[model samples]
Target: MSKLLEINNLCVDYVSPNGIARAVNNVSISIAEGETLGIAGESGCGKSTLAFAISRLHKAPALISEGEILYKGQDVLKMNDKALREFRWNEVSVVFQSAMNSLNPVITIGEQLTDVMLAHKKVTPKQAYEKAAELLQTVGIHPDRLSAFPHQLSGGMRQRVVIAVALALEPKLIIMDEPTTALDVVVEREILNELYDLKAKFGFSILFISHDLSLMGEIADRIGVMYAGNMIELGEAKTVFSEPQHPYTQGLISSFPTIHGPKERLYGIPGNPVNLLQIPQGCNFQARCSHCFEPCTEHEPVLKTIAPEHHVSCHLV
Candidate 1:
């Protein structure tokens, strides 16, 4: 498969009167064309920050301190305003976390969806309207609902509308930051089923970011485990789930219940998430890790390929 998005040594920081909080630290990841790569981590682990940085959507005070965000070999970090505007939505779109609630309450769904196309000058008003209806139907929503305001629709319907908006331009890559986090299990499953269908039909790649490891295993071809802003493990979803190398990954897998297997205790990871502002030296997982070695606390470990297409960051590994 061809590479679609490549992030190298990506560092994102939030600067304010308080201090500089390193949200994403030297994180490197890539996604292939038409592939789905899922990033699983707890809250405040830089999952959302990474998504924002990818689209160059991070506002002032929160900035990309260092990194190379390359989309199809283009430097995303270096793009100017006009170029960045053109790059976003047209090539890459984002379905933000709680995107269902992000819909504008004042506008009808049709207007919101059409506005995106109009902003990009991708279509005329008439054409935008026509495409809006089609996009709604594509996501299993009724075309007539396009005229309805966000408040008039169910949460699932609103979520679908948000997805339709992201699919408006048939973007090559869609950064879905917990796209279904707010929905119930049934609704989430339904939405994911629709998402899978849409991806197959549209032939676009997806970067699915969520805290749910089991859900990621259901959707993503590859999984990258993040801890305290660092990607501690990266590998095929099945490999990462069944044979996790990093201690953090192991604890994460153990925390989630498996339906197919026999019942087991939910062994949650101990210790609160490390504060990004005062990130400890060496392995971030060392403090929480059960298999902490002397080297784990003394020096940081670089991500290294341990097996074919499997990478891990830990002194033990």
Candidate 2:
């Protein structure tokens, strides 16, 4: 697979009156054509910040302090305004956590979908509307509901509509930030299955962001675990789940219940996640790690290759 996107040593910071908070610190990752890469971490771990930075959508106090986001060998950060406008939606689309917030409440679903097409593509009103209806149907919604407002639909339906809008321009890459977090388990499953089918049909890569490691194991070709704004472990989905190298990755896996395993009490990682505003010295997870040692407290570990396409950042490794 050819590399579709490459993010190298990307650092994102939130500059405020008080101080700067490092949200994404020297994170590097890549997505290949038609592949799905899952980023698993707790909230405030900078998963969403990385996604926003890739699309150049970070605003206000959020600043890209360092690194390069290369999409098809083109630097996204250096793109001119006209190029940036064309890059979004046409090349990459984002499905945010909340579908309600992503959509316009007053606009009909059909209109919203058509609006995206109209804004980016050269199409007639009739053609755009027809495409909108087709997109709704493609996502398992009835075309009739295209005329309904966002509030008129169920949570799952609204999410599907959001996905339909993301697929409006047939983007090469889709960044889904907890796209199914708001739906029930059953609805979430259905949506994920449909999303897999859509990806297969469209041949587009996906950067799936979620706190659910189990869900990531199901759909991701590879997984990267983040903690306190740093990537601690990255490997194939199966390897990461079966043989997690970092203590944080192991803790995250043990916290979830498994269907095949014997019944056991779920264990949560001890200690709270590190504060981004004032991160402690050495390993960010050393405070919570039972395996912490003198080196873990004194020296931060860089990512070391454990195997081809597998890496872990830990002194123990």
Candidate 3:
């Protein structure tokens, strides 16, 4: 398939009180049409920051220091405010965490959805309302409930409403950050199933971000493991799960419970993620990585192809 999005050497920085903090440091990844790519990492590992940079959502404190986020062969970093405003929801959309809160409390669900359509589609409010009703039905919600308030909907229902809003413009790619983290396991599974079905039907790509490796393994076509703003590993989902080359990735997998098995103990990665302002001299994960060698503490490893479509950034790999 043809590539739809390509992020090249993307680095996002922040001017904190102490010093410069590299939130996303020299990361790159791409997505083909209709593909699903999962980005897995702990909080502060730069996963969400990357999303912000890609969508041009970074603010004053958080800035894209260097890199180009290309979508559909156009340089996203170079887009003007007018272009960006149009590019945002029309081509690429984001369904943020706890997206239930994205709805305006004062406005009815119908009005909120209509607002998005009216802005992007340049349609009349009446036309926008009809479109919103269609979108609610598409996401398995009742069109009659369009007049309900945001607080009136259940958490799962609210999430579906967000998903429905995300599809209002039928974006080619959707960046979903912890989309199901706030829901129960059963509800989470149902939402994921619905997403899978929608992906199959719409042929839209997704940049799925989460710390839940196990859950991501179920929905992603490929997986990229990040550690302290660096992409430590990338490969086919089965290959990554079966034989993780990066020690950090292996450690992350060990931290998750397996399905269809007795309750085996899960181990957490030791030590906390490195602070970007005071980043270590070598591999950022070297301190917490049990398989680390002396060389790991002195030199940062560059990404190397370990197999067909698999890349790892570990000296020991």
Candidate 4:
């Protein structure tokens, strides 16, 4: 379980005319080889920003203000154009949130998949197309669909195509940013099951990003909870889900209904998420937290280890 990717003191900011918004603030985490690490948080919590930063895909207005992203001991931030080009897809691939937007509407699925291979690897057109068809089959899509356009396929099938594209180069780490968010529950389940099987077969690590904690519990070996650009809790999936430490983490878990447990009133965290541009001092969850004390309002808590492989950031902890 060697460290495949390590992010240290990462800080991402969005600079605009109005002000700078700290999208990811001093967040640090690591993913082991062949492991699946899930990041759970609501929208605007910087989960997607972190994923984009990992791949150096953050465009204008988005800047990496601080920190290091090390992939197998190499600094991703310092990579030159040529090195970065080789690093993406070859070493890492990203499955974006939307399948429809990710793919080219006009380009045939076969061409899109082959184009990725052709761009990265030294392969003949015939060979690239052959690999493309094989990849489609691997993701449970028929090879015949390769000749079809993106709109010609179902939502689930389009998603499978996106997954196939990510696997085109057999990358060591795949950053899945809400890969199944667009599909129906049944389709989502089927795709996730296939994704799990693919991870086992390929032995590739995954950085799974989603707002769904229950889904994260099912697919992730470990879970990291983020709030207002900060990581509040991180631990084994089972431990974090069953015994969440941070008040925010607890609120997120309690908001979801459980099937096995006796029916109980669902509780939602009060107050809205903090504004990143004008974040207040101390804990970001202080405004929404029912357990907020004086210490929670005055001082920001750093991630403190409470148990083996479990860390929490809160004055109460």
lDDT (tens digit, per residue) of candidate 3 on 117-222:
9878978888889989988987888999999999999999999999999989989999999999999999999889989888888889999999999998889999
Local accuracy of candidate 2 as per-residue lDDT tens digits, 201-307? 99999999999999999999999999989999999999999999999999999899886779989999988998787777888899899999999889988999999
TM-score of candidate 2 against the unseen true structure: 0.98
How many residue pairs clash in all the candidates, one count each?
0, 0, 0, 0
**Where does model 3 exceed 4 Å of error?**
261-263
RMSD (CA, Å), each prediction: 1.2, 0.9, 1.2, 1.0
Choose 1 or 2, whichever is better by TM-score: 2
- On TM-score, who's better, 2 or 3? 2
| Candidate lDDT values, in order | 0.92, 0.93, 0.90, 0.93
TM-score-better candidate, 3 vs 4: 4
TM-score of each: 0.97, 0.98, 0.97, 0.98
Better lDDT candidate (1, 4): 4
Residues 178-232 of candidate 1: C-alpha lDDT, one tens digit per residue? 9999999999999999999999999999999999999999999999999888899
Instruction: Put the candidates in TM-score order, highest first.
Output: 2, 4, 1, 3
* Steric clash count of candidate 3: 0
- Indicate the worst ten consecutive residues by lDDT in candidate 2: 96-105
**After superposition, which runs of candidate 4 have C-alpha atoms over 4 Å from their true positions?**
none
